[model samples]
Target: LWGEACATLETSVGPNNFNHWIKPLRLTGLESGIAHFVSPTRFISDWVNRHFAKDIIGVLSRPGQPVERLRFDVVPQAAPGRARSAASGSAASVRPVASAAAPATTRALRADLGAPLDPRYTFGNFVVGKPNELAHAAARRVAEGGPVGFNPLFLYGGVGLGKTHLMHAIAHDYQMRHPAAQVLYLSAEQFMYRFVQALRESTIMDFKGMFRNVNMLMVDDVQFIAGKDSTQEEFFHTFNALVDQGKQIVISADRAPAEIKGLEERIKSRLSCGLIVDLHPTTYELRLGILQSKTEGFRAQQPDLQIGTGVLEFLAHRITTNVRVLEGALQRLFAHASLLRREITLEVAQECLADILRTNDRKISIDDIQRKVAEHYNIRLADMVGPKRARNIARPRQIAMYLSKQLTSRSLPEIGRRFGGRDHTTIMHGIRKIEELLSEDKAIAEDVAMLKRLLEA
Candidate 1:
């Protein structure tokens, strides 16, 4: 009866969902209008109950087996290499992959709930430059699988800056060195999800056991849990427990701990206690190196594709936002050439990636305009956004407002906010005054033009 219902669910919920959330469950029996089942973990059980319980019950509550409600229970896992006896009848049971057994628990958590680690994100493929050298070195030291001085190693940076790559590399290296050591890697979002599930199911103890039992825990994009109060509290305790037990913790976020708004100060202080490393934005040389490395790898797959000289360099120069965008642009070029049978030249790249190129073009920010305008007139930078009405300060402030309006994509209100919370009407007045000066006074026009050139440069 359970088998039939699951077959119907496989189609209803989709294959990936069925396998991850449904296949692990075993419906033992239906009695007294209640369906009883055994789940590998409370996390999966709670998820299945919340998301797919209605579907399962709907299918089971057919003509014969009437299931009024669904219940998911986590039974004790059998010892390794021991199959359950037929005598243990009626109730179906399965051992959790991350059982509370000695030594193998970390590998089990890694198998069951940890985010899938990318095989390509190892240190071997990580391109090193001055920007990321310190981060790479620190990760390498931690991955050496020794007792390190830092209890928690925090890596923070903007998107596509290799924070996740380093985190994966550390896990891969650490697991390889100590085969029996328990290592678990997952994102902060997953941590919160499991915590939420554990709370819902009254299985908080199970959740604590799974997390704190690991020898090493790596959580990526921890900034996601910033505003989540309960998750933050659980994470703080988990963090402290691991540190108290002398276990290693690796965390990655998009920004520094102090900079993440809505995060508790105590959590910030704990995260800051570690050796915090920032993976700086990629330099042109680093981007070129990455492109070259990627192209070399691509050559093995498409040996016939001809790439012209200076194409990689051109891409490196143009795609300066991050490494991911740089690699994605290169991949698009490869795909274009592979499909069209054309050589990948600079001209072909420009023609094929016009939209990307346009979007990646030099972006001017309000901060840049304000700073340049302030410098050009030799007034303090603070005065550009300050509450002052003097002529020297007010003139450059208006010029900055005019240039910001001209150069940036920001709305008037946003621009006004950037200039120390001035209103849009005030911004409009300042911009108009600058426009009147630009047309009538040659000096104002020349100053605006010169500032524009400097800002662009």
Candidate 2:
């Protein structure tokens, strides 16, 4: 009966989730509607009870057999003088109980070394655009599960930009390509917790072996270990061991390696030795594409719901922060329409998402633009609004004029009043000059792009 139920569960949850959460469970007995199962640790037990209990009960409760509730107990280990029994209740729930008879894969899962991969985040679901095309290509190259030309593929970007999504996609693709390979993916915080636990229990050697033996190791949000000395030391060793053994390592963070404050310089250099890819801020076309893709998925779920034209375009233009916020706005709109049994229209959307629209409305001022540009170019604030015709001051002043025109709704004459009472024609010339240089000079383009990101952020 347990074998049959296990087979059914492998189909319900994806293989990765099943292997991580369900495969380590051992059903010892079933009586009086209480199914007793022994788990390697409390974490897996609680996770199964919360997420997969109903599904398991549904499959196990047949006509002749009745199973309702699940009672979990940690696996027992032999002590100094007392022999352990399978039915004994032990308090060692946090640490894993290793079995000599268990297979290597099952033992690894029992160790709880990694987090579950999200089935929704995969290469097929990822949308490609100019800002993220290079990152996407690099992720695909690593997912081939072969020799990683770039050992540790470092992906960094601002929030909601696709770092976690691409990380999960790589893990999924690599697992699919090499089913027998040992792939461990976890957050840096989890790494810290495990290291601390091992230190407390004198199992540091086991922890090191488990981490160093993996075929692929991925650590997300690595900036979390920046200031900690011990965790950083262990992580550096783990990183070096994997790279030296020709194993693949993938890492993600919110910023570039060198830019992460409190991080060790040696660790940053190691991270920078590989191919560093940044998922740039999403473009307008990219946001629109994401909305369209999400709308299609929602349509599948709500086939009868009607969405009006121009709604997506309006959302794409208004919600310029990131992909998550854009998708969330769309989701709220769909839910509002479905709950009210109303067709989605532009006015209805505006009415439904008034709060989101209001929050996303960033009224950038010309003064703010001038201040930011001056600081970026390392010029004085007075020089920004004063008569400084030197190349350094003049170039930044022109860039400030360009940004003010692009970001704010001020007229050219009104902007002229803010910049040392210059004429409207002077503002126009400065704006035009910057525009021409944006296409002709790569440095100016990069500077403008970086400034735009800073302002938006």
Candidate 3:
């Protein structure tokens, strides 16, 4: 009964978890087909009892096995090592059998380690716009594998710009094509927590063994480990181990590795080994495409709900930060419409997302507009805040001042107070100049359009 239950669990739960949690367990004795075992620690015992005990019982009870109950004894860790052969009569012979299953068990363990990759995040579902075309190509290449051309593919972008989506897509592609390859995906925080826990428990080797053995490892938001010295050192070593073995490593962050403040130079350089793909902010067309894609997905779940082209355009234009927020807005609208048993309309969307949409629209201030515009143009931060009359910096600075007056409800004198205490007439002149340039210059017209998009974003 004990052997049958072990075999059933081995096949069902994969070998890695079985080895880590189950293999070490000593089947002490059997009574009335009810097997009792000794686990090394209380944590492991409790975990097994919680998640796998029922399955264990189900497996044991199959074929009319008379297993009625299973029990565990948490013995002294040192004592179990010494008494293994005495406690389990066939332990010496069991060593080779357990050794034979170790590799297969480890393979099974890797299969269950991380969150399942989302099917929707595959390359086919990724919509490429100018903003993300380069990043998309780099990801495709990484997914194709071999020679890694990019050893550590570092993908960075703002929230919801598909950093995680691309990472999942790459993992999905790799696993689908190479079933035997081991892949692990986790957030940096999870990595840090696991490392710290392993260190504290004197199981650092076990942590390293788990991570370093994988054929491919992906850590998202690597920036989260920037300032933690111990975690970074441990990760740095794990990264080197995998890289030296010619294993593939992928990392994602909100910014370029170099720009990740407080990260060690060695870690930064290691990250730079592979291609760094920065997904730029989404363009309007990209936003619209994302909306259409999300709408199609929503339609799949709610086939009866109808959405109009004009409503999609409105949503796309209004919620322009990134794909996540856009999808969130659509989800809110869908929930509201479905609950109310009404068709989705622009008015309904506005009502359903009124608080978010209104707050987003109202939150722009003159200072916000000026700082954002100046940053977008790459003018000196001082030039934006200081008095500058030269055409190069002055022109962008004035445009920023003009945008502040146009976008925010601040009065002219109030706006002046925010921008180097200039007179209200200076604000007026800047607005007039920008207005005149917008009418005559195509370049200025484009700049205005670009600025509007950035400010709104």
Question: Largest lDDT belongs to which candidate?
Answer: 2
Task: List the lowest-lDDT window of 10 residues for candidate 1.
Answer: 80-89
Clashes of 2: 0
* lDDT per residue (tens digit) for residues 1-457 in model 3: 3555667787788887776567656666656876677654433455577667777777767465667776765432442233232223354323322333235434333333444455567887889998899988888888887663588999998888999999988887775455445567889998888777767878676677778877688999999998899999988999999999999999999999999999999999999987888998887788888878877878898898877559887776666666887788888888877888898877777778877665555757766777777787788777877977889888887888887766565689987888888899998998899999998999988998788767765
Model 3 segments more than 4 A misplaced: 1-100, 103-113, 370-441
Give lDDT tens digits, candidate 1, residues 127-234: 999889999999999999676646689999889989998998887777656544556788999998878877897877767887887778999999999999999999
- Model 2: residues with Cα > 4 Å off, grouped in runs: 2-56, 62-111, 370-457
Q: Poorest 10 consecutive residues of model 3 by lDDT?
A: 93-102
User: Tens digits of per-residue lDDT for model 2 on 1-457?
Assistant: 6666767778898777787777767776677898877664444566688899998899879797778899775432222212223122233322332334444444543357677777678999999998899999999999896664587999998889989899988887876655445677899999999899889978787788888877789999999999999999999999999999999999999999999998999999999988999998887788899999998999999998888999998887667777898889999999988999898899998888888776765546677788899889888899989997999999999999988876655789998999999999999999999999999999999999788767766
Question: RMSD to the native, candidate 2?
Answer: 8.3
* RMSD of every prediction: 13.0, 8.3, 10.2
Which candidate, 2 or 3, has the higher TM-score? 2
Cα shift from native, residue 8, model 3 (Å): 20
> Relative to the unseen true structure, what is the C-alpha lDDT of residue 79 in candidate 2, on a scale of 0 to 100?
26
